[model samples]
Target: MGNITETKVYMLDTNVFRYKSNPRAHKSYKKATKRFWRNVLQEFRNGESVLYIPKEVIRELEVQSYTLSEKENQRIAQLLELIEETVPDLATPEIEHQIRKITAYVRSEYKSDINAARDMEYGSVSDARILLAAWQYDCIFVTANIKDFMLYPLLFPQNESRLFDLLSENYVIIDPTVYENIHRDPVFAGMLQDLHNMLER
Candidate 1:
């Protein structure tokens, strides 16, 4: 296993996959973002990183299939096949244990609709179970659905930290924009350039 310093294992949200294949969300997305998808996958191929996804996430995505062309669906299929190589097969024994315990706790403690907001925000039963699993695994919650989980940091004030801290609290919910700005950010780009220069010299 690689040290935490080098490889940041990220739990990808469903929308990242969706945004790539389905052109329905953004009117101009297909024409607009040719390079964006390329860069994200490049990071995956190069980073020596683990792309962890809860089985639930994949199941949900698979079930919620959108209308797309034969070519687009075929592309998504091929992409998933490649991604499967890098995605760590998590959500195994520990996830099963956590889900049982967490479900019991939530059903016993929270039955009212008042906390339903939080429940639904976290995607109710499965999500609560998944978050607990994320905590156990010590991975960042990489998601385009930031709004779905932003309440996490707010609800648990102690979980707050900067973007760089991947394993701070329960999970670090990285927005898709974080990947978008990877090489474009002046600070990080300059640092990368300096590192490159040092390595070359």
Candidate 2:
């Protein structure tokens, strides 16, 4: 984690809103996720940081919520209440242009691999917008699906170098299913440390 300390803006992905208990996950992992969100709420309440969810992510969550279990739906509803700031509107022409360019790049790059192309095409537009929004707004993009966002830089480093650098220095990746892979974002690391300390207590 970087030593940089200042008020921060965090751009959250849709998956971060999920707190559904998974049967296969260890109990501690679920507890950690809950603690993570609790810390988020604390930060929000204290106005120490800004948490932003793109409008696209919110819409995606609403669509997915329809198929989720009642317990999970309730958790999502509670999580939604933590949105203290307005959702960032990602529908501008500039954003649309970036999304199209990214889509074209993904398609052209993965032309030889049909399955890869399909996967890229599936959610690339939305993912691209989210990634771009994080970059555009200079916000730390937090998500459980690190690989998905990391794929852009790994594939096309030339255009996404700035974004790559930002993510490297400030982002947070929280894999809800496991305790080990949660990484980066100094603020979040501190929060995770506090959670660990509480568990020890």
Candidate 3:
């Protein structure tokens, strides 16, 4: 009812998968993960939706192996099996330029110093890559931490107009707690109905 929603083509963030794999992480996130499988993946496997896991997200997950239990590792492995791995075309000048700007933007926002030594070490570059992958594939970028990605456009309104458009038209940022009751909540219920109609078409 708010806007025409895209039911297919989703690009997932690392945290979305992490919450599912790690049992002790957070109850709400785990519930969101379960609901995502029930609500989204069912349609995805049925050929109604396309799902992508960026290579950068995969790398992030791999690095998290040190803290994960064997069961968590197994869950992550199985989860990866269900997604289509996407390698963002980093060769594009636009993408490279955006990544740099996005990294700097994140540095300023999180570290309060754009030239902080953290640089690529703080996970900004990888986040940029994942977002660009969504843009490249026209996939709805899915994440529980929406603010992390939304900060880019807020800093560079003119240069990131396309991203603004993408955010408005395709971004599917969901709060974990809200997502757990998606069908019961009015706002999310409307979104779900919109997606259902789109998929049926």
Candidate 4:
């Protein structure tokens, strides 16, 4: 057999885990969702890729878990255990500085979109912190909340320009929907294949 290939590192968002915990919630695309997660977990199991979850994302999941039904809470507990075994949690003192920088940038650039008085609220900083963690680790930031993250590249044009210059690079953001459609659509498969190929290099 040929040598085993190294794959990209994926820094997962909270929504990705939420969907993994309850793929049936997306009944219309249940099969596709299941296949997507199966492929992702297989990559991890095969040692092709490393998975990371920011500490902030874990905190969010823990908070959300408390509101779930007993069965769901048990399910989440098991999932968290699996994640603890398979994925490394990203945490550092410098993360706070990055979060502050991101918050300042967002507040300044999107001032009209946010309530200035409430800009410093707790919930407002989580996403920024997540993105900063992904950026810091140079991982592929995977999420279901695409629109929210799409703003990052636009907000920081210099980074976008740098990313374009690097033919095979990291810090790209992707949506799990790409995986959800992989079996039914050639386009989705092609997109994932391309990412896989790039990461392997």
Candidate 5:
């Protein structure tokens, strides 16, 4: 609470990963997230914190990472494989159950004896699933999905979205705006270069 440094776990999303490849998204936020990522590596080097990727997040980002850089593409592949070995899959029964339970609860909370949700307005099931992962991991859902995640709540009056605050408290979900805080540290400098050099060999 007082010190931001207390946040030890980070659950990233595809949108956050895509920022490295998509300059347009980075430009919108003034390239803050890009810089933060470099910083994240630096912190990781410095042992500031631990980075844990939900299996699904890794799968989701791989498709995009390949388009960005030969190194990034390859790196994503390696990460995914490692994650597969560890968690093996993203959509497990527990995750699905969590998604379903959250959906049902949210639906009930949104229940009005007035009207039903329109197909277009209700959005997709994927939204709930992503939210579920963030909740379950007790980590932030780091995403650049401004239009969908951030702005959508404004459209609904009783929309009940502590989505950002809720996650920030439990999970520290950094948007492009907050990434610099996540990554900037005295820690990540030569560690990554050493890793790169080792990998090259």
Candidate 6:
């Protein structure tokens, strides 16, 4: 077991939970994803790492769930229940302001980026809220939709140094694919190993 003081914290994006709960997802991939989440929950229960779900993310999921079949909706509800039991929903007064600011800035300034434009058009502003929460908590932000989150720092040239500082301190934005293939991804493997070493110390 890991030391409590050395516990790593993770803030999950909506896509992570959605993909896990997706009924049409391939059986093998679903199995692997469930195994991955089970390990994460076990670690959380052991006080090895913290897991969080932003209120905005939950809102997005809840909105989407209405369109899904009853079975899929139940799956999402169960997943939400598990997450709520594991960690408190994060919210802050600044979150609304931050989301609006991010959406407007990215839409006006980085309009050339199609992904950013589509995210804005599709009302995935949850990304901005989730990012704000991750920044507030200084936790690793994990997501399946990495492009949107990865573009956050690049939008502001003035904050380049601040963004670099966060990256260097290991307050990183990670894609779940990295964890799924840690063996082939040296950077991912190294990060996880470092966390393990910290806990051992």
TM for every model, in the order presented, reads 0.50, 0.55, 0.60, 0.55, 0.47, 0.54
Give one digit per residue, the lDDT tens place, for model 6 in 84-150: 3233334343443444444454445444443333343213455656766665566556665544565
What is the C-alpha local distance difference test score of candidate 5? 0.42
CA displacement after TM-score superposition, residue 108 of candidate 2 (Å): 10
**Model 5 residue 48 lDDT score:** 62
Task: Return the top candidate by TM-score.
Answer: 3
User: What's the ranking of the predictions by lDDT, best on top?
Assistant: 3, 6, 2, 4, 1, 5
Question: What stretches of model 3 exceed 4 Å from their correct place?
Answer: 1-7, 89-123, 151-201
**C-alpha RMSD of each candidate structure in angstroms:** 14.9, 14.2, 13.3, 13.2, 15.8, 12.5
Q: Per-residue lDDT tens digits of candidate 4, residues 32-70?
A: 445555766788788777667788887888898876667
Best candidate, lDDT: 3
Residue pairs clashing, model 5: 42-188, 139-171, 140-171
* Pairs with steric clashes in candidate 3: none
Query: Compared with the true structure, what per-residue lDDT tens digits does model 2 show for residues 1-201?
Result: 986556667777776666333333446545655565676677777777777778788888889878777787777777767664645664455445445454454344442342322233424567766765665566666765554464333222232232211222333222232212223334434543453343344
Cα distance off (Å), candidate 5, residue 107: 7.2
Alpha carbon lDDT at 131, candidate 4: 66
Worst 10 residues of 1 by lDDT: 161-170
User: Candidate 5 on 43-127: residue-level lDDT in tens?
Assistant: 7666664555555665566555545767666645543442212222434444444344433433343323112332112223455
lDDT of each: 0.47, 0.53, 0.57, 0.52, 0.42, 0.54
Q: How many backbone clashes does candidate 3 have?
A: 0
Kindly report which residue stretches of model 2 are placed more than 4 angstroms away from their true locations once superposed: 1-5, 20-32, 91-123, 151-201
User: Which residue runs of candidate 1 sit more than 4 Å off their true CA positions?
Assistant: 1-5, 27-37, 66-69, 84-122, 151-201
**Candidate 2 lowest-lDDT run of ten:** 173-182
In the range 123-147, model 1's lDDT, one tens digit per residue, is 4455544554354455556544443
- Choose 4 or 6, whichever is better by TM-score: 4
